[model samples]
Target: MKLRSLFAVAALALLVQVSMVAAAPVVRENGAFSCTFYNDGETESWTGTPGNVDWSDAQIASVMRAMDTIAGLFSNEASRKVNVSFVYVNQTIGTAASAVPLMSTESSPPYAPKTKTVWTADDLGGRGVASGSAASVNNLEDVWKYGHYLPSDYADVVVTISSALHLNNSLYYGASASGIQGFQFDMETVILHEMAHPLGFYAPGRSDSKTALEVLTSVKSYAGSIDPKFFDGTTTVAYLQKHGMGILDYPYAAYETNDMASLGVEMSKDGSHISKWVGYKDILMGDMALSGVVRRNYSDLELAMFKDMGWSLANDPFVAVPEPSSVILSLFGLSGLLLRRRRTA
Candidate 1:
């Protein structure tokens, strides 16, 4: 009788352990943002140093904190809760990771009232919609009904990170946390940039060569109803002439000459990517990710661009006073003119 009771207890404990592992979603929350992470069914592997660390859980938690920091940057409460899922892919796409819009309102003819709910999915085609939740549905509709500019949904924004990549773990910085030390490539920076795409910073057309003119032109034409002030104070022609084509044009071809292309020049697809033209070096949304450094914060222009996309924002502490170095760099690209490189989609 005693032996049977012990055996029964052990079996029950084993079953419970299995159940916990199966149902457990590695989740982290900070304020308005919550991120859930999963494996892409690939045998998870991390190369180089830190051989014994659980990279997936640690990286996912780090990513969640990064998302939370981004959320705090904007003062407005997210009308629809933003849930993001990170799936670890074992293969390298190109640079590190890529983001795809799982669902979005059509660009042409626009939606009624000019506000539409957009949804993004994971690499596995999982749209992060909440199951059996009326509040989720109601919140999604509220964003559209009120003509809110930002894409609002209670569903998850699916992001995929490469498990095969050597992500630097030494340097870490995020909205709510910082100074996490590791020697690998900064995973936080890559995750932050990719996640921003589903939030409404996207360019139309293929990934290889979406141009700044294409993005500005599209916004100017289709999004006018949503944001009338998009081009109110800005003149592309003057901007091009003053700043030079390299500032706004990707794959910029002054080739052998100093004269820049016309204002509406075409280059790479927008992908909601900022041109290496304006604030090239420090901003999070630029075209390249350097190893070892983490760009955990967004630039003032990036925040302004979010506002232009129709999302409400909080007062930005970073831009209240202009940094003199940035001002000088903008006035003159003191560094020699360099063409923008393509990043992971």
Candidate 2:
């Protein structure tokens, strides 16, 4: 009887150990960023009610792969902890997936340990906090000036994917980039694009590129919605070195228009994305997202943009393939520039 009882206890212990392993949450790391996840499948933040589905093992794995790709790309070690939560919602076709970076309830702590003057500007060009000490902007602007988020800030960039995306065959949730199907969107690529917004590629674009040029031509300065000096001096100088001093017709980066779309969606353009010129059609940060194209890596120009926004690269910029040649002519091209609008918050 004693021997039989011991066997039963040992079997129970094994079962518990397996359960713990199965229940472990997804966590991925890189230089300064560590992304953790919360699977809020049943509780809908919008409705205050429980949903029918929860995140499956496959879904969690898919999101984890996306984080791995992002973590590998950035090399900064400022120690920013990002919390990603998943929720399912009913969205429209071609709308695909949507994500928003929410500011944490916690107030941002002072910028310290390293003292670099951080510059800030207003929508109307009244640049404030010109340069005295390290401070926290308490907004996405902080991500632009500092390599990491403020110490007191909630260090999280939240994302919400459509339940239909994972449930139906709408997304290709495989690890291979070449495996994406013509009828499906690459889940990893989509998530990567969404993640870029919080990491710093976010600005409502200018009214139009034409308007941007007119302001530069007349005033000989950038008067777009975003400050012309948004990029740090290092990035701007490096861009000029690769391109040329005379090549700047408008702002170095393309601007998007804030417009209303068919789905009652608000389309925010510009500084948030690369220009949708001929060569940039498939660039990760371009305004349009095609169905089957896999834009997984950052282009050289996009890397410079990130560096200007204060993110340190984990590796050299544009170290991977599929990076396009410099967009000297494309930056100023005005024809056939019309592209599909995306809704970002």
Candidates' lDDT values, in order? 0.45, 0.49
- List model 1 lDDT by residue over 1-345, tens digit each: 999999999999999998655334456777665565554332211111112123455566667667766767655545555555556554454557766443333332222222213322210012132222111112222332233335533233556666556443333433333453444456677777886765545543333322122223323222122211122112333433554532234333333233233343221244356543442356677666665566777765555445433345666432345689888886666333432222322
* Segments in model 1 whose C-alpha atoms lie over 4 Å from true places: 1-23, 39-57, 105-154, 166-183, 204-215, 218-267, 276-279, 316-345
Alpha carbon RMSD to native, model 1 = 16.1
Residue 181's lDDT within candidate 2 is 79
| CA shift of 112, model 2, Å | 21
TM-score, each model? Answer: 0.54, 0.56
Q: Write one digit per residue (lDDT tens) for candidate 2, span 1-345.
A: 999999999999998897654333345564434554444334433223333345666766777777777767655443355445455556666566665554422333332122224444421022233443332222333443233555442334546566576568777777677878787888778888887776655532222222111111111122254332223234433554555432233323433432111011011333455442342233576666787887777666556556544455677653434435435456535333533222221
- TM-score for model 1? 0.54
Cα misplacement distance, residue 189 of candidate 2 (Å): 0.7
Runs off by more than 4 Å, candidate 2? 1-41, 44-52, 104-155, 204-237, 240-270, 318-345
